[model samples]
Target: MVYTLEVPNTYGYVVLGAGVGSVICNIVLGGPVMKARKQLDVPLPNLYATPGVHKNADEFNRIQRSHQNYMEMLDSYIAMTLLGGLQHPIACAVGTVFYYIGAILYQKGYIDKSLDVDLARYKKGGALKWIGFFTSMYSTCALAYTMITAK
Candidate 1:
């Protein structure tokens, strides 16, 4: 008997999902940190930013919140992936793409949060929030089903 390493073809989507998702996540997190440094006028490393920094800056807080939410979602995605147990190649891959798209939208929408006078332009109608949430749910279901049915 010989054992060969062969990943299911459908897993390609899963791989792409992780790769692109990571890049998008980094952007979400990194952009805010940079903006925070500039806004707070904190020197290198002193960006040890506390919420107090946003006392008068609404936009800064929005950016900070977006980063925090991304971290939380990342944890959820990891758990779902683990529960999915590397099975259901097709479902896993498809779910991953949708998940990434949802996260991107979610981050964009949250970052856009503002109290600017031009409220109309700044307002995001919760599109990203719902998209990210539903997709995250769908992926969870897909993973659970696959794990439950696996032999």
Candidate 2:
């Protein structure tokens, strides 16, 4: 029996695996978790408000639109990750670049006022919160590993 030594292609494999895992996990658990969070009867703080009067119906609708846009951004990001993982090395490179850009933006307070009050209610130190945190952490780690291992 001869064992041939092939250098482990860690980067390619990790990216592909993480991408597939993210798509599956999000599709399976994301909707249900979001729905449950919506059911929580908590009032979210208003991040945006004009000086005098509170937000009118139209303003509230605008805020909802922003949230929808954010969700769409997330969907595209995950899709990109999966596509990169399954495609050429360029995809992995793109994924790595996007990750770093997001990290930098996050560090610079680009996302500070983006949290919704109702969504925060679900993160009140319970099983759901832990699960959410762990899932995010795992995904982050997977992406980081893939980026680091890519040649």
Candidate 3:
């Protein structure tokens, strides 16, 4: 006799898991990675010397701390969703795909200086910037929501 594996209706759990995962990963791994990249490009001391440097630094540190909290929160959230069990592999896989795609776009030139306002206005009212902006936003939201809601 031939046997086949059965799949469970875990879409809701998957979505929530992925959503929580994305948020946690983005906060923990993604934020530091992006900050490191920014440090390479602009350097931290230079960042410290900017007009609102103190305020900015405070905000940045707050965000970093928040990411750490988010990571811990994810553990609890996942456990709650999974009920002390592992998440479905398919949901994890799909979440990973979305996470990487967003990461790549963000790491590329999508959020660079050329896309900033003065240049955007100079180059005819920011069509490309807006497109990129919307794309990033949509991708991020979809990925987060899908991860959170997947069962």
Best by TM-score: 1
lDDT of each: 0.55, 0.39, 0.41
Clashes of each: 0, 1, 14
lDDT leader: 1
Query: Please, what are the lDDT tens digits per residue for candidate 1 over residues 1-151?
Result: 4323345666665655556665666685667668776876644654244456645355555555556655666766655643342455556555565555555555556666443524422254434344444554666687566556656
Instruction: Compare candidates 1 and 2 on TM-score and give the better one.
Output: 1
Model 1, residue 133: C-alpha shift (Å)? 5.2
How are the candidates ranked when ordered by TM-score, highest leading? Answer: 1, 3, 2
Q: Give a tens-digit lDDT track for model 2, residues 1-151.
A: 4333243355464464345544553343334324323443213453333334543433343334333433454554554444444333444444444443332323223222355544432232222323323333455556556666666
Span of 10 residues, lowest total lDDT, candidate 2: 103-112
Residue-wise lDDT of candidate 3 within 54-147, one digit each (tens)?
A: 4345334433333343344444444333432132444443444443344333333222344542332224322332332333344445555655
For residue 93, model 3's alpha carbon misses the true position, in angstroms, by: 15
TM-score against truth, every candidate: 0.59, 0.29, 0.31
